[model samples]
Target: MIDWARVGELVDEIGAEDFEEVVELFLLEVDGAISALEAAAGNAVIVEEQMHFLKGAALNLGFEALAQLCLKGEKAAASGRADVVGLDEVRQIYRSSRLQFERDLPDRLAA
Candidate 1:
């Protein structure tokens, strides 16, 4: 889920224009990471690396749920259980988070 407070703080610090740019860049980066993650398949090391990167990025943007998922996946992958990560679930969460973020962002920012 999106953290409106964190988003607000970020917007306050960077202004709307820059925040948008950051969000755009973040989405692009995450998309690439997700693609790589999918391609990693059952490679535990690759999954761990990608999940670690994703967790950090998600945390930075206050995508709390996604971050948690990434952390779980990271730990699992670290333990050589990449199959537990379940790419479908991760993709679903990301899509949901993205939809909610896009839907509520403008209103939240205006408020």
Candidate 2:
């Protein structure tokens, strides 16, 4: 299950007035990065670069699960494990996490 208390804490840290806009922007960027990483999985360098970007972005946004997955993908890509299956798994996890984040965002912002 998602940690909504952590989400609330993050929003409070970032300032409630700007929380919604920032969350929306982060989600949009993360979604696009996930797509790019999926499409570039055949190229190890590209995949690694995308994962690195995603890792930092997720971490900064306090998206712990997404950050962890991106770190795992980065490690795998760095070690030359940029296979289709691995990329697909990352994409699926990203999608699931994104959905959960969206579902809980309203409450976080309201707080």
Candidate 3:
């Protein structure tokens, strides 16, 4: 669900001083995207584009579980199978991933 190593790499690459800002930006942007996704629901075009964006952002943040779901939805939408993609499930996974990431990041980073 979370990739601690990748998260550490990102923190190192971006520098600790700027990590919080990055986290804020991530949450802000991802929240907007998720809202758009909800509005679009199973719309193919929106799902394809939004899911692609979500997948990349999620992977960058080490939200592997969310990224995987986004990838699957993106592919399905791209293939004209948008109906099979569960937007609710995607949102649920993101919410869950975010919770876990928030809960564990401090300890994991300190360690």
Q: Tell me the alpha-carbon RMSD of every candidate.
A: 0.9, 2.5, 1.0
Q: Tens-digit lDDT track for model 1 on 22-86?
A: 99998998899899998997899999999999898888777888899999999999998998878
Single out the weakest 10-residue window by summed lDDT for candidate 2.
82-91
Q: Highest lDDT: which candidate?
A: 1
Q: What is the per-residue lDDT of model 2 for residues 26-66, given as tens digits with 9 covering 90 to 100? A: 77887788788767847878888888888887776666777
Q: Which should have the higher TM-score, number 2 or number 3?
A: 3
What's each prediction's TM-score? 0.95, 0.76, 0.94
Q: Model 2, residue 42: what's the lDDT? A: 74
109 Cα displacement, candidate 1 (Å): 0.6
The clash count of every prediction, one per candidate, is 0, 0, 0
Sequence-dependent TM-score of model 2: 0.76
Give residue 102's error in model 1 in angstroms.
0.2
Q: Model 3: per-residue lDDT, tens digit, 48-96?
A: 9988999999999899999998899899999988767687798789899
lDDT of each: 0.89, 0.74, 0.88
- What ranking emerges by lDDT with the best candidate at the front? 1, 3, 2
The residue pairs found clashing in candidate 3 are none
**Residue 21, model 1, lDDT:** 93
Q: Can you tell me which runs of candidate 3 are displaced by over 4 Å? A: none
